[model samples]
Target: MNQPVSAVAGIGPRNEEVLATMGIYTVGDLLTYFPFRYENHEIQPLSEAEHQQRVTVQGTIHSMPELKFFKGKKSRLTIRILADGLLVKVVFFNQPYMKKQLILNDTVIISGTFDRHRLQITGAIVKPVEKIERGGLEPVYSIKGDLKQHQFRRFVEQVTDGFIHDIEEVLPESLMSRYQLMERKQAVYYLHFPKDEQAFNQARRRMAYEELLLFQLKMQWFRKNERQAGDGQSKSWDAEAVNAFIKRLPFELTTAQEQVLSDILSDLSSIERMNRLLQGDVGSGKTVVAAIAFYANFLAGFQGALMVPTEILAEQHAASLRELFAELKVNIAHLSGSSKVKEKREVLEMLASGEVDLIIGTHALIQEGVNFSNLGLVITDEQHRFGVAQRRTLKQKGLRPDVLFMTATPIPRTLAISAFGDMDVSTIDQLPAGRKPIKTHWGKRNMLQRVLAFVDKEIEKGHQVYVITPLIEESEALEVQNAIELHRTLTEALPHRRCGLMHGRLQHQEKEQAMADFQSNAIQLLVSTTVVEVGVNVPNATVMVIYDADRFGLAQLHQLRGRVGRGADQSHCILLADPKTEVGKERMSIMTETTDGFELSQRDLEMRGPGEFFGVRQSGMPKFKVADLLEDYRILETARNDAAKIIQSGALFEHDSYRSLLMMLESDIAFQEEKVD
Candidate 1:
């Protein structure tokens, strides 16, 4: 089983072990590992096969020559062959065993890179004693560990040839015909071995569409079940209380914000449980809207919990909410792992006794002993920062609380639909009045002194500065500055300057202390990582210097830029980029061109394409292998139409075609029902 014979077409047990060591074992796995590319032999005639554009040559081996060693460092074997009445040279490198496999007058089918002077046959998988048919097309697959391309391709062809008839048609005939998709069996064969580019395209389309359709079907069923099961539970808030909260805001709300708030309040008041996603750009006052929501519920004699991803952010929210609702007479509490045991015990007691109207914290809000007597609203900041389980844990604390998730990351509208199809969406596109745009500028590393001077100017004016670095640690390959190193350098450069350092490696208390110092104006400069991308607001910080701005995505840069321009004072964002590549230049260009986060997000998708921007690992958006949220907008629209049609027909539960889809969705519902805490 471990020999080279296992990979070769027909070798004995003794050869199998030799092959196994090279990593080839079962024939099936061997076959799936295809070549990266094919050397097309059809470009030139067989006579000029060696010189031909790249064609397969069919000829009889005239002689098997002796092995020759070159410079005692390399080995080579040459065979004289006749093809189409012309003589050609077939050469092999470091393959001494091939001499034993090939004989004089044997017909050979060889494939490889070819030049006019020589036929560079990189592989000798097929050595027949007689002339055989050559290639018109070839198959390629991603190489697997211990798998050689030549042997893998041949094995796949053999296995596929044998199982072609056994393949069951998973797609119905009517659907295939309607969509003009290739037959199931033919698609499997053609996908591995395409006759032409057109065939390849058809096979790819069918597979991509099928995968997306299946995922969409599953999402649709889950959404239906949720709406049906979660209906008739949401209670109304006091309208007078909500209107009064809105009226008391320091700045007037934008029309978009007002519309969103109205929709959310209405949903919360309806018989159906509220499941909504609130999307907006950075500094769009989403938190203010959330405050109004919590106030509405608070006035209705219930509690609301705002869950953030970090302790710093949770404390920030608690402070901001307090300021926003100071006149509303709402009692708010902050809870986190950092809270003292006595403090946490007191907060939990208040929560269980219905004394706390609004609570803000990180995961501590979902602690085991923390219970809510009248929890009616659940709000999560930076929704993607926390995992699915964390959100469910908060939901478990309430009696089917109305979940409101907020995110400053602007996703393409098409993606926003599918990713959050289970919930209604409210977008705040317009910024509030008096919100100033951060002036963005591009500069080189040499201009660091000028940027520092600007920071000093801001500091002299009684303002603060945030200097963001791409990395936390120093590395030889990276010429750009790092947070830790820059923090030391700047503090040294300006001896009188009080600078604070914040990064992920720091303990929670240390980070909080650093941030608190910055917030209180004790520190004139704050050097930190992108971990400060969320809801930590310092209105007094008026200058932001981002090093290696190109290294960050446009969406992230937008968030970083947002850290400034929060006060009435004019703020500036200095973007430092190396512009080493096209990608780097493109990303920086976006920052210099636009202050609109949503617009930058769209540009990022267009430049980098959606595949690199979204995935299960990054955005945790639904993973659609071939369906791009930006490019596949048409398909998503079609899926929406199809869903509406099916639902309108009222035959989803009665239709056999949807039965399997419904059953598959049961698992998602069951998973959601589990006690997360």
Candidate 2:
């Protein structure tokens, strides 16, 4: 099964290179490359077919196939076929060679879109009835570059026939009996060429279960190994002192906040190192909860470090922490890439000397010169923004310090389990007291004047506004507004208001200055891209206007909306978009209907699958070929439970039943480690 593609029959160097482009390097890859969908060859009458419906029609050629040569090498072949006493025109593009095969009066099966209004069939696949297997399903694969569907299908068929029996089973016999699953080899073969719908369903169920089970086992194994690597320091702190500090806060803590804080403190005092994810919506008092955790870490005689994504966010967090810890006398330091050299050096010295109890910074905290005398806790804000290696680098600065990750982007529960199953999760489901929900409105481009008038009114009331554009600069491809052009236009439209522009293309200092100007109310309107989507809080910024709002996902739209409604006063989010699709319109409607991040996240996951929900690359989510995190959540839950039981029973390494599973897990771990390196 592990043999290279060159070992296969009829596959030469050229075909091998093409297969490599599709990630089919080994025979095993070829066998397991399941088709996305299957097309049934069951014939249907033309009279029963709806317009633009995909159907298979068996017809006799009624006219000679006309082949016409077009621009450069392009060609088209057209023919007339009679099915159910109805004559339909069949068209094939870029397939002039098919004219010779399609003979007049020959019975052929054509499968593609059937347009009833035009009496036309756009033929995707056409084969003579005598040569084609009737009442069978044809697999459709996603291929690229020079490899046609027939060629790829032949490759998979050949591999399956030759190596199907070589596929080893990972599930134990007990599980196989309990679940009534077919053999792995049979399932793999059936997935490529199923005899019936039931066969295909069984194959899919077996394969999906195996993939999910292996993924869960890998997560459980890694967690077990991490816990066994070293003993966590049992940090002790005064609970009454922490309570007193929380009581001293200017605002009361929500019940959700208190619960999450309690979870963090409980983890801190345990001998097991804490690896937790704290999720909350924007302006849900997560920062305050983090402050309490830092205070607890300080009381335990261990320094804590907070790492954020941007300098602007780091500074904001620093200011908030300073005010929150004022009476406690805890020394806090702020560091960033643009910090003055002398100040940075002094901060580093104080950190290494154990003088700074808490430090908040951007990626600068993980730099070479940064060190800590007793770093016991590390908190990364907007955790998804940082890569695994970046987080690991900061954690490596200390001796297995407890790690806490915070993200304002609330992921759905299904994704949370699949992506962060290795760590514990705590959610702040409630917002702080007296915080009014942001009012959202959808507007068309024709209503720009009205939206601008609303912005002007908000500015007159001494509040700032955020004008979000989808692009940084104008492009011929997209007709939406760009940040630079929008900034110029807004500045011209409202001459009395000051407009500041910020985007990813700007220098760190320039972006910082823009944010500072906006924070200081020097800029009444800020026209920016999605750079300000996370952790840029300004209570006076009461209005958010997003142009081309349909271009963004639901989660991102929710995050942008969260920028407003940070203060007690009522806020508004104006979505200026003329959506062309139902999905886009639904997204705008959902944004206007609710401000709950988790609900929007779930809807977003349902709309755009898990791979795109958090961006597969940075999300640390497993890329399962068969199982879907959203659709197969119940299977995932079962797999998780089964894996936990297997690990707890201490039979994974000791019993023969789990030998193959263990080997597969170890190989996956090695591959992951290689990727990280």
Candidate 3:
């Protein structure tokens, strides 16, 4: 099964190159390249066909096929066929050679769109009566350049017929019997060429289960290895002191916050290193929880590190933490890329000298010169914004310090399991007290004047406004407002109000200044792109106007809406979009209906599959051949449980039943690389 494409009979050197372009280098790759969809080619009478519907009909040719040339190399072949006592005109383009094969009075099978008004059938494929595989489903693959579906299908058949037995089973026989799954070899063959619907369904289920189960096993193994890496620091802190600190806070902790804090405290006290993900919606008091955790770590004589994505956010966190820890007399320091050389050196000296009990910074925390004197915990805010390498580097600064990841993005349970299954997840589903839900409304282009009037009114009330656009500059392809143009227009519309423009194209310092100006209320309106989608808190910013809101996903829109409604006063989010599709319209409607980020995330996952839900690159999710994270969520849960049981039994490597699975895991390049990392 690992043989190259050149080893196949029909695939030559040219075809081998073509297959390589499609990422099919080996016989195994070709076999696992499953079809995206299937076409039912069961013979149906023309009388049962509907207009513009794809149908397969068998007919006798009533007239000679006429071939005509047009526009240089282009050609068209037209023929009339009689089926079910009806004469239908069949047309094929760019395939004039069909004139010779389509004989008169001969029965042929035609499959394409049926046009009832014109009594015509635009045939995409036609085969002779004897050559047609009647009453069977035809596999339709996504092909690349110079690769025809029939040719690829022939190659797959050759490999399946010749080497199906070589496909080893990854799951044990016990699992197969328990799940009523078919043999791996039989499933692979049936997936390529199924005899019936039942066979296809069974084949799909078996393959999907295998993929999901293998993924879960790898995740479980990684988690086990992580737990056994080294003994974690059994840090101890006075519970009464922590309670006193929590009581000293200006605001009370929500029940959800308290539960999550308890979970974190339990992990911190354990010998096993804590690798946890703390996720919640925007303005859910996550920062306060992190502050409390840092305080406890300080009580244990261990330093804590907080990493954020942006300098402004780091500064904001530093300021908030300083105020929270004022009464405790804990030494806190701030660092960033923009810090002066002398200032950075002093901060580094303090961090390495055990003077700074807690440090908050941007990517500068992971730089080479940064060192910690007994770093006990590492917390990264907006965790997804940082790459895996960055996170790993920071964690390595200490001797296996406990790592905590915080994100304002509320990931659905399915995604959380699939992406971060190795780590424990604690979610803060509740917001702080007295927080009001932001009022959302969809606005059309014609309502721009009214929206601007509302923005003016908000500014008059001493409240700031955020005007968001999808692009930084005018895009020729997209007919939506850009940051520059929107800034100009807003400045012109409100001459008395100060407006600031911010986008990704700006320098770090420039962006920082923009955010500072906005936070300081020096800018009454800020016209920006999605750069403001993350952690930028300003209580005075009460109105968020997003133009072309449909261009963003539901989760993103929810995040942007969260920018407002951070204060006790009622806030509003106006979605100015005229989406053309029903899905886009539904997204706007969903935004207006609820403010729950998790609910929107689930709906977003349902609308866009998992691959596109979090963006495949940033998601760090494995690409599955047959398993779907959303559609096969139940199978995923089952696989996770079974994998956990196998691992907990402590016989994975010792049991002969798991030998094949172990070999497969070893061969997985991504899994091996992760193990090394």
Q: Cα RMSD (Å) per model?
A: 5.9, 2.6, 2.2
User: TM-score for every candidate vs. truth?
Assistant: 0.81, 0.94, 0.95
lDDT of 2 by residue, 485-581 (tens): 9888888999998999999999988998999999999998999999998888899999999999999999899889999998878999999999999
Model 3 / residue 496 / CA error / Å = 1.7
The TM-score of predicted model 3 comes to 0.95
lDDT for residue 514 in candidate 2, whole number 0-100: 95
Return model 2's CA RMSD, one decimal: 2.6
The candidate, 2 or 3, that scores higher on lDDT is: 3
Task: Rate residue 541 of model 1 by lDDT.
Answer: 91
lDDT winner among the candidates?
Answer: 3
155, model 2: CA deviation in Å? 1.3
lDDT of 3: 0.89
Cα lDDT over the full model 2: 0.88
Each candidate: what lDDT? 0.74, 0.88, 0.89
1-677: candidate 1 lDDT, tens digit per residue: 11222445554465456446645565533432333454443323565444434456667788776688888657888777776677767777887778887788877666555566554444434445242233355555555445566655665666566656655454445456777887656766666777777876686566555555555555555566546644636666667767777777778889998899898888777767777899998888899889888877777677999998888889889888888877767999999998999998999999999989999999888879989998999999888677677788898898878889999988777667666666678889987788788899999888888888888888999999999998889989988789999999999987788988999999988998999899999988999998888878999999989998888888888889999888888999999878899988888877889998778888877876655655455344664433556756776766666655555465556777666444444544432443111
Best by TM-score: 3
Query: How many clashing pairs does model 1 include?
Result: 20
* Backbone collisions counted per model: 20, 0, 0
